[model samples]
Target: MLEQTGLKVSSRYIAQIKKKCGLDVGENFNLPKSKNARQPQCTPEKKEA
Candidate 1:
């Protein structure tokens, strides 16, 4: 978007500024899981033979 304003800035600098400004443009950190990620499971212990 800065290109429209004729402003020249690196993406790293823009990311830093965005973080400082508390913008929600970043990935959603509130999510507890990610897409395509597998869920955890537990196996029961075997009884004595």
Candidate 2:
């Protein structure tokens, strides 16, 4: 994404930033799981209440 913005950043710099933010810098870091199904939408009556 940074490349699309014409900004060149090294992996080491990214790792450093992640370390500063207390995030894991492991090569096999696992992202949090997301829901596979979409959430049910609220009805108009519910919104009015």
Candidate 3:
């Protein structure tokens, strides 16, 4: 599927797969850290009062 999308199976994306899908199975596999994901961060205080 990824190859069809012209996307190389890089380590970063592999980590994401391990995280979102919980499919880690290799020595070099690394799960994407939920807290440190490259997306935006919204702490409770920032989102509310």
Question: Which of 1 and 2 is ahead in lDDT?
Answer: 2
Per-candidate TM-score against the hidden true structure: 0.36, 0.44, 0.30
Candidate 2 per-residue C-alpha lDDT over 1-49 given as tens digits, one digit per residue, 9 for 90 to 100: 2555445555655665667679898773644467584434443343232
Ranking of all predicted structures according to lDDT, beginning with the best and ending with the worst: 2, 3, 1
What local lDDT does model 3 show for residue 34? 84
lDDT of 3: 0.49
Give the per-residue lDDT of model 3 (tens digit) for 1-49. Answer: 2556544355545444556567764664555768667753333342232
Query: How well does candidate 1 score on lDDT at residue 4?
Result: 62
lDDT (Cα atoms) of all candidates against the true structure: 0.47, 0.53, 0.49
Displacement of the residue 14 alpha carbon in candidate 2, Å: 0.1
Angstrom error at residue 34, model 3: 15
What are the clash counts of all predictions, listed in order? 0, 0, 0
Regions of model 1 farther than 4 Å from truth: 24-49
lDDT of 3 at 12: 47
Pairs in clash, predicted candidate 2: none
Worst 10 residues of 3 by lDDT: 40-49
